[model samples]
Target chain A: MSEEHKHTNYMRIFWILLTLTIVEVGMAYTMQSHKALLIVALVTLAFIKAGMVAAYFMHLKLERKTFIAIVCFPLILAVVLVIGLFPDVGFKLGGKHHHKPAASQDSGHAVEHK
Target chain B: MSSVALAAHPPSQEKEILGVSSGKMAMWLFLGSDGMSFMGLIAAYVALRIGNWGIWPDPTKVLAIDLTAINTFILICSSVTMVKAFAASQEGNVGKLKQWLFFTMLGGAIFLGVQVYEYSQLIHHGVKLWDSAGRPAAEWLHPAIQGHSTLFTATFYACTCFHGFHVLSGVVYLAFILIGVMRGRWTVNRIEIVGLYWHFVDLVWIVIFTIIYLF
Candidate 1:
């Protein structure tokens, strides 16, 4: 195995997670008003964390295709299930009036002029 | 060469039944079903909380993120150690595998320990799983405060504490595997199977970290 490559990846992931976590704290403290930005930031950071773990720690970069496929398929199915449950998940999270309606609804980002 | 060409072909259809081991397969299925179970709880919360016309809690405002963030690091570290254990086994270094397994177990224990501490802090902060200072949820501090509902705390404790229980089981699993290694019952394949379970546990935590703590 390429030891240096693994080391560099680990270090990079460490720095990225640290930076993102710091940003999370900063945003939490700084951002005010129930705006869309905070949610976007949190989710983006989450996906980044997931990416790093999958690539490095899980060795997805080096994993066999069959195993990777097995893992990925289930995760995809899961995301779909969660997405399908958006109405329920949305309410559980906070509510429509809690914010995001003006940004998410009809004639909003859900459907575009283009 | 004729021999080399023949080796590339698939094994004949009439062969022994072999695929993912039943135990490992069962574990994966269990994890998958558990994931759905959690998604259902969370989804129900989201749905009902929304329907409540803004009665639920603001997750970020109330959760002790710093403690949980450290918990995240601890769990992720365990995942790294687990893979290391698998790697050691692959390299035929049983001693290294045992050491890594011990560290992996240590990491898991630290996570559970931290979680217990966090729970204590929350309870002290006037939020118990079944009661918010002995008043109805709507009567407590603002629902937007994140721990408003007895329901909220109930789900929180149930979800995370259940996850912790799995981590504990994994600790025992590692112990069995370690003892097996000492008795030379382990093959590289066994390491892979255990590593797969460990990895799945870590994966579940990753999602839990996002939903429970961050999102």
Candidate 2:
């Protein structure tokens, strides 16, 4: 009985993953107009697919909460790392006023390389 | 202890680090720490990209997304086969275990093959590393990619090549395990450990595909 149950579950998960991939690819073209929306949608779908792989294929879903915590703890640090970069990632924030466009400084830096 | 005594006194579930075998627990810990490495690469990529803002290459034109989607599907199938291999091993069905293990390895090989082909195509299109001379003077280059070839190519190679290296190692590891199975030296537990690694590779690819390709 357990064998049959696992077989069905694996099959189901595979189909779901395949469908999600198709949908994500399809959205790649159709969602071009709304860039922000497309990124959010793509990331959400990818996370769902990743969740399926981890929970079923890796058998994390059947594992104990402690295992899940072990898996998730590093991810929290990862998130914090990304978040830490955001303040200086693209926009101008308070600093030493040394932020200049790479193009504008090309002449000065180009001489050093030469 | 006799086999009977050992069998009767399996490692205490409560004391075995959340009931998982130490080996499995160690694998999970390694994956956790390794996950941070990938996160670092991806975060660096994203930061550089956001810094560049609108000038970053449009991956749809520069990358072979359709081909990679097919590759992603192949990897997903491989993950499925890996799970099936584990199930067969647990059932003590050596034949199915060998079959599924071979299929999983084949999937990894195909993925690596496709990646090599894609890299060759990109190189022909003038995508390369360490050449700060910018995009090749080739007329075939995508207009969006022409000015930004260095950053795009460098990050692309860094992120994907690292993942590709993982896939290569995975295929090699799977082959070793398959040989063990053939020689009747491997147990179901060993296969499960390798499967854990394989599944984690697939999981990382999921994030890479979204961030690098689709986004």
Report how far residue A80 has shifted in candidate 1, in Å.
2.8
Instruction: Score every model by TM-score.
Output: 0.73, 0.88
Instruction: Give the number of the best model, judged by TM-score.
Output: 2
Each candidate's chain A: what TM-score?
Answer: 0.68, 0.77
Per-model fnat list: 0.18, 0.70
User: Candidate 1 on B44-106: residue-level lDDT in tens?
Assistant: 554544455345566666678888878877877787787778778877898999898899889
Query: Model 2, A1-114: lDDT tens per residue?
Result: 566787789989999999998999899878878989999999899889988888988889889997798889998999899866765554432232343435333343333234
DockQ of 2: 0.54
Tens digits of per-residue lDDT, candidate 2, B1-215, equal: 58677665554322367877777888889988888999999888888787776678888878889999999999999999999999999899999999999999999999999999999888776566533556455555645587763577788889999999999999999999999999997766678889999999999998899889886
Residue A40 shift from truth in candidate 2, angstroms: 0.5
Give, for candidate 1 chain B, the lowest lDDT window spanning 10 residues: B9-18
Model 1: colliding residue pairs: A88-B47, A91-B46, A91-B50, A92-B45, A92-B46, A92-B47, A93-B46
